[model samples]
Target: MEPTRLNKYLVDAGVCSRREADRLMEEGRITVDGRRAVLGQKVTGNEKIFVDRKPVKKPESIERVYIAYHKPVGIICTSDPKAKDNIIEAVNYPDGRIFHIGRLDVASSGLILLTNDGDIVNAILRAEGQHEKEYIVKVDKDITDEMVTSLRNGVHIGDDRPTLPAKIMKMGARMFSITIVEGRNRQIRRMCEAVGLNVESLKRIRVMGIKLDDIPPGKWRFLTEQETSALKAALV
Candidate 1:
């Protein structure tokens, strides 16, 4: 194998993110061939590596891990510079860098998908005209039967195209559920507001065939082998 950037090698091997690996190097925690390596160094497969005096393994040899986090309402789905208390901080995955498959807003939460497999992220997020997300929303006031019918058929929520026909289930006088294939920013909240309902709470309980079930708020678990395949299949 050819050489690669030191940080990329370390991140791919599950040691840390590329940025965190850079910190480890700056702190004199990484070495190449028994000599302390500096920032931005590249390492070939032929070189020996150490981190904190222990050998560093090759990146391609590591297995990836995926997780399902039942994110709480306050967390955002991101790994950007401003992502304090976001999904990345919430799970604190100790191995390879895992990122959310799509995103959930800061005020809406449940079943956020995390994966180190970058391909899966693209598969789930960018697949045009494929897959769907389902959310259960509670509002502060009752919705008239007429309003429910309006949302089901379509409403002008400042979008050029009418929303795809949604599956709306009336749960109570002030509660209902909607399933949508294409996601837009604050799509659910805006959809409700368009018909004069104030969204009091929003929780995504299902994505395709996966359900949030008993997963607690603010914690995460690995996707079962079956779940991984099912999730990928759903995107098709």
Candidate 2:
């Protein structure tokens, strides 16, 4: 068996992300063969490992799992409280605390991510970075050229700060597609409301490099291997 750093091994085992493993290492929360192990210490699988005094099982080399769900409107994004239309209940996924990479409001719907990898989840959702999310918005009134320009330039959405610059394209007389790198809560709705347009429907069509494609609302599918690799590459 090849020797590897304990922290790296722990991360690969899905015990924690690499950063969390490093933090635990610094806190002296790991041991190998009953000896306290340092952060960078190397070990082989034959040695016993414990995290927080509990033996760490040898993680099965199961393929990393990822899923994409086309959430329907009226479903909440949370798992707790067990609402009538919670995302978790809708999926009927097996018991595990899988989390969405980002959020969609209870009134909105579209592409949502479900993953077991904490590292991937953190990389995609970190708010300080730039990541474009595209949405198809239907408004109550016909959108004008000036409205499209205003959306692209940025507008005050009754927030303490102005909305970020965005890319907007006319889809129909009363519908448009908008892409914005910054995600604020109910941001698309608020921005449209600020410009005298009431959003009748909003659906996320893309997140960064991933598109919703033909996925139907209230349905989910496993990510193809290529899709998984592409997403991981985009994060880096």
On lDDT, the candidate that comes out on top is 2
Backbone clashes counted, model 1: 0
TM-score of each: 0.76, 0.73
Q: Could you report the Cα RMSD, in angstroms, for every candidate shown?
A: 5.5, 5.9
User: What would the per-residue lDDT of candidate 2 be over residues 1-236, giving only the tens digit for each residue?
Assistant: 68988876775565555565677778778888998888779878888998767676554653456888999999888644335777767876663435567789998889998776766866776643488889999999999888888889989987798888999989899989999998788889989988889999999988867789999988888888888998898888
What clash count goes with each model? Answer: 0, 0
TM-score of 1: 0.76
lDDT of 1 by residue, 31-116 (tens): 89888889889887678888767676676776888787898988877664355776776788886456677778889988887777
lDDT (CA) for every model shown? 0.78, 0.79
Q: What is residue 203's positional error in candidate 2, in angstroms?
A: 0.7
